[model samples]
Target chain A: SQTIHQWPATLVQPVGSPLSLECTVEGTSNPNLYWYRQAAGRGLQLLFYSVGIGQISSEVPQNLSASRPQDRQFILSSKKLLLSDSGFYLCAWSPTGGEQYFGPGTRLTVT
Target chain B: AQTVTQSQPEMSVQEAETVTLSCTYDTSESDYYLFWYKQPPSRQMILVIRQEAYKQQNATENRFSVNFQKAAKSFSLKISDSQLGDAAMYFCAYTERSQGNLIFGKGTKLSVKP
Candidate 1:
């Protein structure tokens, strides 16, 4: 069985502060990783996705970025956060042409 | 571009009853996949069920079954003998054939009253 882990299940950051969220998958290799954000009571919006290491595809233009540093490790970062950046950030992994498996998720509050 | 729609924003059902959530999608591709994901207050997106476009038979997993209407471009989820734990926000999602990204709808909040 494969399990996905994300760090800092919840966080509160001041505007203009740096942000970093990590996601890793265990028991799977070379899986597709994705970054999504969901506003309160809203559907998820895909931010970024990576098919392989060092290859990230951004779905929407935003202040955040994602990196696939390793086969099972993915990182979402931002140099300076904005108030609008606050949301429920989620990390998901999927096998090639397979359904996605989501992590526990990180709730970010930009104050 | 593909678009998913869940008409009901919120619905409630009594425990031990049956409930069906409606979903419809717009896409030009013939081959793709549709999925229903449940998000509890805990905020984890759990895959409830999935249906492939090429299949005619409805996909069923225990008490959860999908009504896949290919001709109408509608995919609905039916929960049988609903339990209190079935209360959650149900989202309808669509993925392109051989593609990785999932396009999701606004989601419907299902409340199971005990």
Candidate 2:
């Protein structure tokens, strides 16, 4: 069975600080990875997705950026965080294009 | 572009009852996929059910099922014998077969009464 892991289950960062969130998948190779953010009581917003290493497509234009450094490792980063950047961040993986499985997620709070 | 819509912001059902959450999507392409995801209080997104556009039969997984009306562009999720554990925010999502990226709806919050 395949499983996804995310680091820093919860994070608190000061405004203008750097941000880094990591996601990794085990038991699967060459899987599609995605980064999503959900505001309080709102639905998810797709930030970025990668089909392969070094390849990334961004859906929303914001301060955040994503990278696929390895086949199963994905990283979401920002040089300077904004107050609007605080939200629940989710990492998801899909074998094909149909169903996606999500990780535990990271709750980021920018003060 | 493909778009998904979930009109209901919140819904509630008593335990052991059946509840249906409505979803509709707009797309120009014929080859696509629809999915329902559950987000609990923990905020973990879980796949509840999925429907393929080419398939006529509705998809069912255990106590959860989807009503896939391709022509109407409607895909609804039905929860049978609802349990307290079923309480969560449900989201409707659509993705093109070749696109691979998913477009999600606003989501509906479901509450199960004990």
Candidate 3:
């Protein structure tokens, strides 16, 4: 079975602080990885996706960036956080575009 | 560009009753896929159901089923005997036939009352 793991279930960060959220998948290799953000009571917006290592495709222009350092390791980062960056960040993986499997999201609160 | 629209922002249903959530999408491609995802208080994105646009038959799983009308671009979820555990935010998403990413709609929050 494939599973995704994300760290820092919840975080409180001050404005202009650096941020890093990591996601790792188990039992799969070369799978597609995606980063999404959901505002309070809103739908998820795709921020970035990677089909392979060092191949990140961004859907929406934002202050954040993504990197695939390994076959199953993906990281979402920001040099300086903004108040608008506060939201529920999700990490998902897919195999051959069938369906997406998500991890327990990171609830980021930027003050 | 593909876009998904979930018109209902909030919905409520009594326990053990049935409820249907509406979702519509726009896409120029003929072959694609539609999906519904559920997010509980835990904030885990759960795959509810999926329908391939090329398939004519509706897709069903246990108590959850999708009414897929490819011509109308309508895909709705019908939850039979809705349970309290079914309460959550439901999002409708669309993806191209070979695309690895999904385009999601503003979700609809479903509340199940006893």
Candidate 4:
């Protein structure tokens, strides 16, 4: 069985500070990875997705960026964080046309 | 661009009763997929059920089932004998045949009462 893991289940960052969230998949190779952000009481917003290593697609333009450094490792980063950047970040993975599996998610609070 | 819509923002159901959550989507692709995901209070997104657009018959998983109408572009979820554990924010999602990215609706919060 494949599983997705995300680091820093909860994070608190100061405004204007940098941000980094990591997600990796185990038991699967060359899987599609995605980063989604959900604001308080809002829906899931696709931030970025990667089909393969070094192939990243940004769904919405914002203060965040995503990178696929490895086949199953995806990282979300920001040079400077904004108050609006606070939200619950979820990492998901899926095979070709298969069901998507979500990670536990990281609750980021930018104060 | 494909879009998923869940018009009902919230819904309630009495325990042991049936409740249906509505979802509709717009797409031009002939081959695609639709899914219902449950985000419980724990905040973990779990796939409740999935249906392929090509398949005419609805998909069922235990107490959960879908009424997938391809022509109507409607895919509604029916939870039979709902339980307290069924309370969660249900989201309708769509994935194109070519793209692995799944588009999600705003979600409908389902509250189950005793």
Where model 2 places Cα greater than 4 Å from the true spot, the runs are: none
lDDT of 1 by residue, A6-46 (tens): 98999999999999999999998999999999999999999
Cα displacement (Å) at residue B33, model 2: 0.9
Model 1 residue-pair collision total: 0
Q: Would you list the C-alpha lDDT of every candidate in the order shown?
A: 0.95, 0.94, 0.93, 0.94
- The candidates, ranked best first by lDDT, are 1, 2, 4, 3
Write one digit per residue (lDDT tens) for candidate 2, span B1-114: 678999999999999999999999999999998999999998999998888899999999999999998889999999999999999999999998888788999999999999
Clashing pairs in 2: none
Going through the candidates in order, their DockQ values are 0.77, 0.87, 0.78, 0.74
Model 2 lDDT per residue over A10-108, tens place: 999999999999999999999999999999998888899999999999998999999998999999999999999999999999999668899999999
- Model 3 regions more than 4 Å off: none
| Model 4 alpha-carbon drift over 4 Å, by segment | none
* Candidate 2: Cα lDDT at B4: 90
Model 1 docking grade: medium
Looking at candidate 1, what is the lDDT of residue A39? 99
**Residue pairs clashing, model 1:** none
Query: For candidate 4, what is the TM-score?
Result: 0.98
Would you estimate the TM-scores of all the predictions? 0.99, 0.98, 0.97, 0.98
Rate residue A80 of model 2 by lDDT: 100
- Of the two candidates 1 and 4, the one with more favorable TM-score, higher being better, is 1
Model 3 lDDT tens row, B21-54 = 9999998999888899998889899999998888
